[model samples]
Target: MPWILAPRRHRVAAGVAAVLLAACTSVPLPPERPAPVEEVRPTVPHPPAANAVERARSRWVPVDWTELPGWNDDRIAEVWPALRASCGRPAPGWAEVCARAMLEPPADDGTARAWLARWLQPWRVEAPDGQVDGLATGYFEPLVEAVRQPRGEFRVPLYGPPAPGTMAKPGWTRQQFDTLPAAKAALRGREIAWVADPLDALLLQVQGSGRLALTEADGSRRLVRLAFAGHNEQPYKSVGRWLVERGELTLDTASWPAIRAWARRNPQRVQEMLWANPRVVFFREEPLPDPSIGPRGAQGVPLVPGRSIAVDAGSIPYGTPVWLDTTEPLSATPLRRLVVAQDTGSAIVGAVRADYFWGWGADAEAQAGRMKQPLRLWALWPRGARPQ
Candidate 1:
C-alpha cells in the first residue's frame, strides 16, 4: 500500500525551559485493551484436481503465465482448509491476544496499562464524553505522541531547530521498503485487525518517530526521520508537483509555517489529502539492519502480487515458489500467476493465507488497496521433505 506522510501540524510557541521540562516529565504509556478481533469464515472454491501438499514439495519452477491466473484462484481455495486445520479457530479472546502481541516484550499488566496511556493521548476521538473510557484515552493518545516524537529521544522535533535536509538519490523510491526482506520477515505470523473488517489480513502501517542513517548500495549515508505513511502514496512527481500544478500551492511555498497555515484554513481538505495518500512503512528507534526480523528469527513471507496464499514458514522455507489463481473485477479470464515468496508481514501470519505488498509508490498503493478476492494456492518445496 502507499505510504503517505501527513503534513506536520503547526506548533504553539514555547519557552526553552518549558520545552526542557516537558521533555523530562513526559513518559510514554502502553495501550490498554488488546486489538479487536473479527471472525473469518472459510470459503472453499472448486478444489484443485492435484493434491496441494504434493505440489508444495517440488523444486521451484516457472509455470506458464497464461495458466497462472486460473491456478492462483484454485490455490487460495485449497489452502484455506489446510490453514484452518493447522492454526485452528481464532481464540475466544483473540482480540486481547492480538493487541497484547503488538507490544514489545517484557510488558506486564500494569506496564500495559501505562503504555496504553502514553500511546493513545494524541488521538482525537469523537465518542461521547462518557463513552470515552480510560482505555481509549490511554491507548491512542500515547501511540500518536510516540509517532510524533524523534526516533531516539522520543521528543518531538522543534520547529525553529532548522534541521538540515537530506538529498535524495536516483533510482531509490520510498516504496522499495515493500521488497525488503527484513520488512517482510517482520510482518510474518502476526494477525492484523482492520477498521472495517474483522478478518481483513492486510494491516495498515502508519507513521512513527525515529531517525535513520541509511547506507546506500554505494556506501553513502543520509540521515532522515521516519515518515512512514505521511505523504500520499503518489509519486513525488504526481502528488508533490500536482499540488503546484493545480495552484493548491507552489514549489517554494512557505516551509512548515505556510503549510500549517493552509491546513488550518482547510482542515477537511487536508484530511482528504492525507487519507488518499497513505503508504505502508516500518520504523523503530534504532535503525535496524533489516526491518523484517521479528521477535525471534522468524521470517515474514510475502504473498505473490495479485494472488492470495496461506503460508506456514515452519513448514515452508523462504524462497519457495508458489502458484496462485483468482478472478478479477468484471473480467472473464481468471488471473493466474507464479511467484516467489520473497517478503512477509504481521498481517500475513495465517497457515492458510498471506498478503502481497504491491511494491512502491502511488500506482502500487492504489492496486494494493483494491485487491480483495478469493484465491487458490499451490506451494513448491523440495522433494521428499515432510511439511513442517
Candidate 2:
C-alpha cells in the first residue's frame, strides 16, 4: 500500500464527553493523592520558585521530579519513539531539546530516565483555581469493513464532502440528510464506499477517522484510511447519553459496546437512536502506507498507541512530554505513564482534561469506550523553556 497525504483535523469522539460526564454525575471526585514512591533515588531539589506562572487556560507550578507520581516506576524507554515523534514537529522553544534528543537516543530505561531528568524539569499542570486534578477520557481509531461499490448487504454509504457550494452553512441534521430531498440531493454521488451497518459508519464519523478494510470491485482487499473531511455543522448530541436519559441504560453501562447491544435488541429503533445525534461527519479516502503507523493527529504526525494523548494545546503544547497519572478504564488499577501531547479535540477543553488515544482494534475500542477516570499531569519541559 502507498501512503497518501491527508489533512489532519481534530479527532475527538464527538459525544464522548456527554457520555462520560453523565456517568460521573452526582459523584464528587476524590482529592488528589500522589502514588507512593517505590524506588529511592538521590535527587537535588531546585531552588524555590517565586510562584506558579499563569498560562491562558492553566497554571504551571514548578515541582521537583520526585513530586511526579510513579515517575520512577515507569518504563521510560517505552516512550522514546513517541518523544522522537514529537521532535519531528517540535513545539515552541523545543528546537534545542529536540536536536539533542535526535543524537542521544538512550540505551535503556535507566538511561532514558536519567537523560530526561538531566535535560528537563517537571511542572505540575493545574487549573487557575489551584486544583490539580481533572477528568481523563479515551478515544480510538475505528476499523470498519467496507467495499468500493455497494453490493449484497453493504448498503450504507460513507460520503465525501458535498459539492463545494452545496453544503448548507449549518447543514441539515442527520434525520434531514436521510429524509429531506434537498439534503439527500446535495450529498448524492459523494459516496466513498459502502458498509453493511449504519452503526459502523457512525463509529467512523464519531471518531473522525478510521480504517476501511476495503474490498475493491476487482475482488482484491486492501486497507485504507478515511480521514475526516468536514461536518454538517449541526450540533453534536450523545446517543449514549440519550439511552441513559431514557432509562435504556445507566450511566455506568452507557459505553459504545453497550449502545451497540441496545441497538441490536431494538433494531427497529436503530435509526431513531442514531437520529438522537444531529451531527454527520464526511470523510476523504487516503492510502494506508504502513500498517504499524496510526493515523496522523492534529500535530500532523502518526499517533503511537498507549503513548499519544489529546490535550488542550493552550494547557500543554503539542510535542510536550506529559507524565500522566490516571487509572485504567473502569478499573482502579493505577495507569501512570509518560505520554506526549500530540492531538486535540472539541470536547477536550480545560486545564486538566485529556483524551487518551487507544490506537485501533477491538481491545482499543473497548478501553476507549469505557475510559473515564480522574487524572493528574506533569509536563516534562526543557529547562528554562517553560511556556509563559
Candidate 3:
C-alpha cells in the first residue's frame, strides 16, 4: 500500500513532460513568397496617306461605254462610213488614225491632237512627230498655247424655240414622241422667245446678243456673235475613270453605249448608278447635240430657264453667278446672258456648263436635243482674277 501511493504522483508528472516535448517538435514555418509580373500589349498599324495627284486621280471612275443605249452596232457601223469619207483615202495605217480621229478629232490645222491628257496638267496630245510607218503615231503639246488663243467670250441662254430667221429644216414627228407636261408647264410665264423649224418644229430662245471679236497679228479685227442652245449633262474624264475603278464598269467594255445598255437592262439601278458616279454635269443655257442622226431619236433633258447654270463645283465655289454666251445651235447668231452657276454635276467639269433658254415647239426640242459642243470657259470670282 505504501509503494503504490508514492509511484502515482511521479507517473503523472512524467506523462505531462513527454506531451509538451512532442508538441514543440511537430510544426514548421512557410517559405518566403515571389513577386507578380505584368502583361504586355501588342501594337496596331494604320493605312498610308494618299498624295495630291493620286487623290485627284481617285475621283474619276471608268464608264461602261458599251452599256450606253446610243452605242448600237448598227449605229456604230453607220457612223463609220461617214467618218471614213471625211478622213479621205485610207492609208495602210488608217485604222488607228481613224480610231484616234473618231475618239478625238484633230484641230482645224490637222497639227494638234484633240485628246487632252488629264494627268499632264495643261498638256494635250499634239500630232506625233514620227510616223508609225509614214502615218503619225500621235503627239503631245501644251493645250493653252497650242490651240487657238482663247478669246474672252461668255455663253448666253436661249429660251423657247428658234426665232423666225433661225429655221433651217422641215418639221418631222415620230410615234414615240411625247412632250413632258412639266416642261411645257414650266415654259409658261417664263421670259423667252420661240422659233419654228422644218425638223423638230419648236425652238426656245435663251441668249439674245453677244459677240466674239478676234484680233489677228496683222491687226485685223473679226467680230463673231456667240449663239448657244440647250443644256449639257455629262461627266468628263476623271470622274469617268473613278467610276470604272469602283467596279461600275470595265475599262475595255465601259463605253457610253455599254453603260446605257446596262442601265436599260437594269432600270431600277439607274439612279443608284448615277448617284455613285458623283460626277454628273448640268448646263443652263446650252444644249447637248445627239450623236445619232434622224428625227425620231431620243432628246436629252431641256434646260430649266433662268434658274440654272453648269458647274464643276469642285473647282469653282458653289453659288457663284456666271455670264455665258455661245453661238446659236445650227446657226451663227450670238447668245449671251447672266446665269447663276449654283450646282455641280458628274459631266460638268472644267467650268463649261451651258444654261439653255427653254422655248416652245419641235424645232426648239430638236435644237435642245442637238446642242452639245466642246467649249472654252471663263470663271468670275469676287476680288480674285477671272479664271480660264
Model 2: pairs clashing at backbone N, Cα or C within 3 Å: none
RMSD of each: 21.9, 10.1, 40.7
What number of clashing residue pairs does each candidate have, in the order they appear? 81, 0, 119
Output the number of the lDDT-best candidate: 2
Give one digit per residue, the lDDT tens place, for model 3 in 1-388.
0000000000000000001101112111100000001111112311232311111111211222222222222112212222322223222233345445456543432222112111112211111221101000000000011101223331121233323333223311111011444333433333121112101010111111112233444556443222222221122122223346667666444432344455567667654443432211111221113211111000111122322243444433333333344444456554433333332322233323332322222333333323332232222222212122
Candidate 1 structure quality by residue, lDDT tens digits, 277-366: 223222223343433211110122211222222233432344434454444322445555443333232223333333433322234333
- The true-versus-predicted C-alpha distance at residue 234 of model 1, in Å, is 29
Score candidate 1 by lDDT: 0.27
What's the lDDT for candidate 2?
A: 0.74
lDDT of 3 at 262: 59
lDDT order of candidates, best first? 2, 1, 3
Count of backbone collisions within predicted model 3: 119
The TM-score of predicted model 2 comes to: 0.87
For each candidate, what TM-score against the reference? 0.32, 0.87, 0.23
lDDT per residue, candidate 2, 184-261, as tens digits?
Answer: 999999999999999888778777788899999999999998877778888766777677779998765667778889
